[model samples]
Target chain A: MTAFLIENKYTVGIMLGVIFGLASRILMLRTDYRQYPTYPHGRIIHISLGVIAAALGAVAVPALFNKDYTAITFLTLAAQQFRDVRKMERDTLTKIDELELVQRGTTYIEGIAMVFEGRNYLVIMTAFFSSLFAISFTWYYGLAAGIVSMIIVLALRSGKSISHIASAESVPVKQDGPDLLVGDIYIMNVGLKVNQELIAERGLGVIIKPYNPNGKATLSNLGQRQAILYDLSTILGVYRDDGEPALIPMAKLDMRDGRLAIFLLPQEKNASKAREIVLRVPILESAVRMPTEAKVNQQEGS
Target chain B: MGEIKAVVTMHKQQVGGGAPIFVADNVKQMEETAFLLEKLLDAAVHDLKNGTFILVKHK
Candidate 1:
């Protein structure tokens, strides 16, 4: 078996590379509470793309070894294909969001799309490095490299959640006359007496206090706030249905201190669990702002 | 900001614009009209605290 492997080294190397690449892709493709990528169909589409990405990455190794330099340009072509994948994800998610009771805001959708694009590149890297090791060194070395790279890539992919930046505390849903408030932060004006009563009785609220200016900037992003509302509604189940805009969930910022107050009318009404969910909400990449890292802020601590 | 779909007010003289305006005879009638408009138009009712409620379709 070892003698035959040496004879057909390129084939064995490519096959192993493809396997590792596909494995990395599969590991990255997760169906969490978001239920995004749908079910069987979404999985199929991504897996097929993964296979293609793996093949492209694996082939480039042998191509480079054979002095077929022109083949490297195919990686660029593969990049174009992945860009289309991002666009496809964005378009699909945006259309689906319109029908959602709590829509995933554009920033969240963009982050998801970016993840799809980035994962493909990670798969390529995994395949390329694995194939290079297999062709240059040994199959066992290639396997080791593949495993190490997969761990590293996944670590990069697993970004921080809201809890890393801010702390979420359960707060009372209050109404001061017509103004609906979550703690001291005024959310909105509840016009109808019936709606106000329903909110006061069944509503849940949370106060998200950012640890620093960076978290504050991120929390204040409209898209980030919408993402929080979307996740809360999805997990806890929103009380309102079609044509009930008055009972919709909202995250209002306390301009005085950049504190976020979320008002939700959940079907389950579990305040502690809801606060946990708020803390665990994925921070959108686009929404992440590092104002403290700026030159002016660093210079004088202003 | 959202488009004001309609207005339900006890005093018609207070509001005037391109959007449709609904005038009610009293406080009870104004609340009832605002609630109905909210459901029908799929909009949020915001109280002006002066017996005027604006139904806004928040996009």
Candidate 2:
């Protein structure tokens, strides 16, 4: 048995690479608070794709060793397949967003889809690297490379949040007659006196102050603002049900100063937690705007 | 979606049951009201293909 293993070390290397690649994919796959990639079925689909990715990655090294250069083309095909996975996720999420109480905007949906697609490439890289190291050096080197790749995968899992760019503070939710205001930012008019009273009693307000021009520009995007509201509603629990127009959480920009004022009636009235959620809201890739970096803005600044 | 037909009406008195009540005299005013509703109430204006815009707010 030991002699057989020694003679066919490349085969053993490929097997180990496939295992590590699958492990990396499994490690990255999680159904979190959002309940995305939902239980059994959703998870099964992704896992099956991960297995295919792992197999493809593992076989490439052996194929290359035997001078089968055409095996490299399979990687391109795998990439196209992964892009389709991204499209599937986007289409699914867009359809689901239509039914959400607080909809994740297009920017957020796109960001999620992009991440899903990118992670598959990471899986392929992890498998390819492990296979390469094992075939070129030793089996132990492959194990080391796999571990390192897994760490890289873990590090790249999540993107930066709003807190990285701005600061969020709890503010007073003030009512004057029918006008609902969050820190002088007019939220809405609660025509019903009873609803006004409920808002006065239960509403939580937050003001997000951007630290720099970049943050300010990002906050200006309607999609980013909507993303903030969605994240807040998702985490803290929206106070209102479907068709209750008055109770919908809103994020409005203080157009003059670029400050964002958010008004929400939360099931959980913890102001600090709400603020934390606001700060932790991921900045949507599509909604990110860097006016500060633009030549026109720079010229005006100087 | 076709070119949006302009039909603007303004309501001075408050409507009942927490439903959004918009009052505007012209297209500009209607747009302003719609903007306020969007920012303040998080309502979306959907064109119904019947030459009318329905402002719907999702919780």
Candidate 2 chain A weakest ten by summed lDDT: A188-197
Kindly list the per-residue Cα lDDT of model 2 for residues B1-59, writing each as its tens digit.
22222222344342223444455665566656554554454454443333233455443
Best lDDT among the predictions, by candidate number: 1
Tens-place lDDT per residue, model 2, A1-302, is 75665677789778878888899999999987778898989999988899889888888998899899998899999999999999999999999999998888888889889988888888888898898898887787888999999999999887788998899999999987667899989876654444677899999999999988899999888888888888888788888876466677888888888899999988899999999898888888887878788999899999
Best by DockQ: 1
DockQ of each: 0.86, 0.07
DockQ category of candidate 2: incorrect
Query: What DockQ does candidate 1 have relative to the true complex?
Result: 0.86
Error of 1 at A79 (Å): 0.5
Clashes of each: 0, 5
For each candidate, report what fraction of the true interface contacts it reproduces. Answer: 0.86, 0.03
The CAPRI classification for model 1 reads as high
